[model samples]
Target: MTDYVSTTPGLFPLPDWAKEDLSDLKGHQKGDLIGGDEDGEIAAAYEEARGEVIDRQREAGIDRIAEGQLRWDDMLAHPLAVHDAVETRGIVRYYDNNNFYREPVVSGDLDFSGDVASELEAASDRVEEGLQAVLPGPYSLADLATDEHYGDEAEFLAAIADFLAGEAEAFPDHETLFLLEPSLVESPPEDGEDERASEAIDEVASATDSEVVVQPYWGALEEKVYAHLLDADVDAVGFDFVSDREDNVYNLQEYGAPGSISLGLADGQNTLVEEPETIRERVEWIDDQLPVSAFETVYLTTNTETFYLPYAKFEAKLEALGEAAELAEVKAA
Candidate 1:
């Protein structure tokens, strides 16, 4: 018998109540609240919305729950863009997606203000257990940002890593911490750069007692990059099975994954959700191909953030994943 778990992305489509609240205000943006935010109404709205999503995850029989990143305009760049040390510049395209986020230009050294930790704290108050925190991986954050503070490339990467490490240290107790690193695929590291990226990830991993999952999406990483990721000390590494399954499978077969690996079986970008049986079959097939003990824990997860999808579709996809994981476990037993 195999052990599996189902988890969705941190960024999700806003709930109707939260949407209504935001729209009622004239100057409201993603995180900006309407009505002048005098009484922290928008902040409260995010918490209430987070509670609604937590309930949705429970209703769908999902395992770990997230706070939905409702306050974040974009998961990767929003924290830095809002941080005091960085200045928000023009919006930049998020990877190859149609969505864009305000770019954070680094003009000074980074200061960790427990921004992510505060999100987890709010989420912890809502859910009793199995809470997961997701954040932008150091490499991806650095890659996406405009760094003018550190002249040397390695210095910049290290500074970003240390900054994120501070953020991880302050996080409340949680089940899992997902570090999303889409830049590994968007701006694949140059020769010998993957190792440095891995080091940066490890720096963050070391700060948390919770299992840290380094997930690179949009596409499979290059073979060498994948190897470096596997060697990293994180508890697990994740792959995007939706976009380029063939290349991902080849990497897993060629290099063999670590003891714990996450599989992005659901397509987050699309509106159509697959049947449970189809997802079950895909999981079983991949499991059979991996070497014995290749994975002790396989996380069935979203290929990317579900912020692009409608709320109903996102909930349906989560329901399917929970059912699919159960089916696969039963079949393996």
Candidate 2:
């Protein structure tokens, strides 16, 4: 029997109060508000927002909850943007979405800055259930930024993998860690690069006792890229069924599912709320496509970040996901 759990990809929509608090810091760069007098104010807002998000997730019966990533104004690139070693360059479009993030320029040796770890620690104290921490995968982070210090791409990736590994080592209390890798689907690694990327990912995953899930969204990964990831040391790999359901399902049929799989059932970018039964049916369909015992546990989640949705719609999506998980569990029993 496969246990079904519900979680989001993090970067949830900010609540009204947090938004208002950020309004004054408009012209300031991403993460600039985290110092001096503004620091305490902003931190308070984040705490309130995090509590609200966790409370909502609990109310919806979600098994794993994130810190809402309220400080990630620059999205996944935030961890790097906030680091003193990395310089923020011009704005870049985030994947294919209308959203944009400050491009992180590697100016010096990558190092653990303790920003994310501190936030995770504060959030950990607020939540009762297992808290999940989110980060950009090494390959994806390397792809997103330009390197000025590291002469070679592989060197830069390895440095990033090490930095991320150090961050993971700092947070031994987190139950799950999600490494988002949209670049894998958008720009598949070149021939020999796949092995290097996988090794870097393994390095980060090995540093954590928490269950690490590498979730690549936007679209289905190429056959070769998908195959390489299965060999990585991560606990589970998430596929975006919302963007390209047929192709993703076909990939599973061809390559076989991983030991643990996260099936993205909710469309995070859209405003329309999917019915709970509809999501359950989709999960059931995917389960039918996989061989029995192929996956030990299946996670139900949004295809991408819920920050793209309005607060109300994001809440609705969470409710739908929770309901679908319950439905799947009852049917499996």
Per-prediction TM-score to the true structure, in the order listed = 0.95, 0.95
Give the alpha-carbon lDDT of every model.
0.82, 0.84
Per-residue lDDT of 43 in model 1: 72
Tell me the tens digit of each residue's lDDT in model 2 across 19-105.
766766454533343321246666676688888998999899898888888778788887788888888877788887788888889
Q: What's the lDDT for residue 281 in model 2?
A: 91
Best by lDDT, which number?
A: 2
**To one decimal, what is the Cα RMSD in angstroms of model 1 from the true structure?**
2.3
User: 227-286 in candidate 1: lDDT tens per residue?
Assistant: 888777888888888888889889988987767888888999899998989888888677
Question: Each model's RMSD to truth, in Å?
Answer: 2.3, 2.2
